[model samples]
Target: MKTTTAFPQASRSRSGWLIAISLLLLLAMALISLGVGPVSIPLETVWQWVLQRESQESLSEFTILSSLRLPRVVASLWIGAALATAGVGFQCLFRNPLADPYVIGASSGAALGVATSVVVGGTWSVAGFNPTSMFAMMGAIATVGLVFVIGSSRRGTSSLTLLLAGVAVSSLANALVSLLMFVHDGQKTMVILNWLLGSLASSNWQTLPAVLVLSTAGMFWLWMMARQLDAYSLGDIASQSLGLDLFRLRLSVVLAASLATAAAVSTAGVIGFVGLIAPQIARLLVGTRHTLLIPMSALLGASITLIADAAARTVVAPAELPVGILTAMLGCPFFLGLLLRRPRTYSRPGRRGG
Candidate 1:
């Protein structure tokens, strides 16, 4: 019997149009998100503001748009894109449909790092990164390293082992975070809880630049490896037989994904399920080809994040809900549905009647 891969060459032809549509949809969502909040700015005004054609009478709108909403919107886009792109990288590398930063403990670890920093009471910065971000990056990398080490054996890491190890590590990290919150003062505890729940409300111009740079660099590096990921999707033996260096591919993917995840967690405080949900949806739409999948996933992720943020802001006016809570509510059901399905569900990408 001939070996087969999930990604078919035929899908490549439509990737351009798919990405174009996704970009358009993401733009629409961003525009809508900008206009939604405690004070409603009309979509028309939002568009006018975007074009720098705002009337002098709309100065208040301009202040809210430029000073408040824009940074949060931009952060949502970049952070969501980073997480979703990292999800693609992780799922490809692990050859597991369920793999993601949140599921694999990277987010928990990063959050714990941030909590630790808060407890330590630090005012430190390195290369435009505050102590929280530095610790987050380190924690993400360390947790991923631990998972790989624990999952590895004489035959190397298996998907099941990695998944199980990740769950155990995630639980451990979460517990430690809770302990820190319990031991700290009320103010520190409040800060830790806020970060844990995940909010883009605090995203401002000051920190947005660093997040943009890190996420862009990390996601770009992953995008460059799309070809390798597609090859790896063919399975370990086949990819290695094709002269693909599995070790190099794994290292590159893990590092890039971890960096992206860290950037997101540090900025948005560990939003869950975007990474898990976005790539699967993208794969269903565009097939398993990472080139198409990456961009589509990024756009979808951005749109989802924006919508969640909009709801978080407006759902309880004056008192906002954490964006993470909304994503978790949406993702939990979708994740459970995916889990209940037969294993064959993922055998063919973009095929509905599998």
Candidate 2:
């Protein structure tokens, strides 16, 4: 994790205009997703439906779209955005381009927590927050904290240590999840397995608001720290000299990332790759400043998930694939391609000017 190679410099995000275009693309993708479901609705009809002025068409499609697809799509959007934003924070905190929300085992820990909750068979709520989410968040925080502790036990936590610790923790969490599934009944086993695989199937109006609150709060916190994150990219000492409380900033960023990630997993059961890939795509377009990277990542993440969800339902028709599966299919190759090409370029990190 120690090195002399300088971090790659990106053009600073000088204007917000490009980000505006990303928002527009997100809107277009949402509409397209609405029309591309199992029961396809015409683009014109969907457009009218969205506009809310009465159309001379049947209401069944609208009902299906609203009651079912709407919440599902909204869940995907929230989870995607949250995860992608989390990824940005982690990348900066760890000073590693490949760092992601799951890189520190947050997703696996959240899944394990939910699986335990299901087996425990108690539906507790705190201030209207469901126990599932509460437990998931706790697990994610605990896991990330553990990884952080172990990774930093020897020295200032290096990216290699953090990543290695994360892999170990992730493996342990998945093992525990498997153990829980095996001890349970067939019905419970199926539920656990499905949740682990990830889907937006469980999302509904009842659960949407919780995710919204978490996403809003977490993203806001991260955005507010964007400048500190940019400073961290200049290396830890330089960031500290810039009046950043490096320890507190790193802790806050990690916690924020964990909170968003846990909420997404709680709502949609560990949808993968949105966190890992979206930020990279955003960086390519909007450069590396966290202010620009965060929003752009969120938009791209939401759009990718919507498109993936659309394909998930229609690809096998009646036998729908999990959205997580689709993400893996897409992400694995993209990730490997990143590794395969210019392998050393991204890992190099050092100080840079604001």
Q: Backbone clashes in each candidate structure, one number apiece? A: 0, 0
Error of 2 at 86 (Å): 0.5
Give Cα-based local distance difference scores for all models: 0.85, 0.81
Per residue, candidate 2 scores C-alpha lDDT tens digits across 19-84 of 888788888888878877678888887777788756456488888778888888888888999999
Q: Each candidate's TM vs. the true structure?
A: 0.88, 0.86
| lDDT (10s digit) by residue, model 1, range 1-354 | 122456574556577688898798788888888999999999989988989996888989999999899999999999989999999988887777778866678888887898889999789788767787778877887898887778765476666677788899999998999899888899999988888889999888888898899899989999899889989889889998999987678778877888888889987887989999999888778888777789889998888888889899999998899999999898789768866773566666675553
User: How far is 162's C-alpha from truth in model 1 (Å)?
Assistant: 4.4
Off by over 4 Å in 1: 1-11, 124-128, 146-165, 334-343, 347-354
TM-score top scorer: 1
lDDT of 1 at 174: 89
- TM-score, cand. 1: 0.88
For model 1, which pairs clash? none
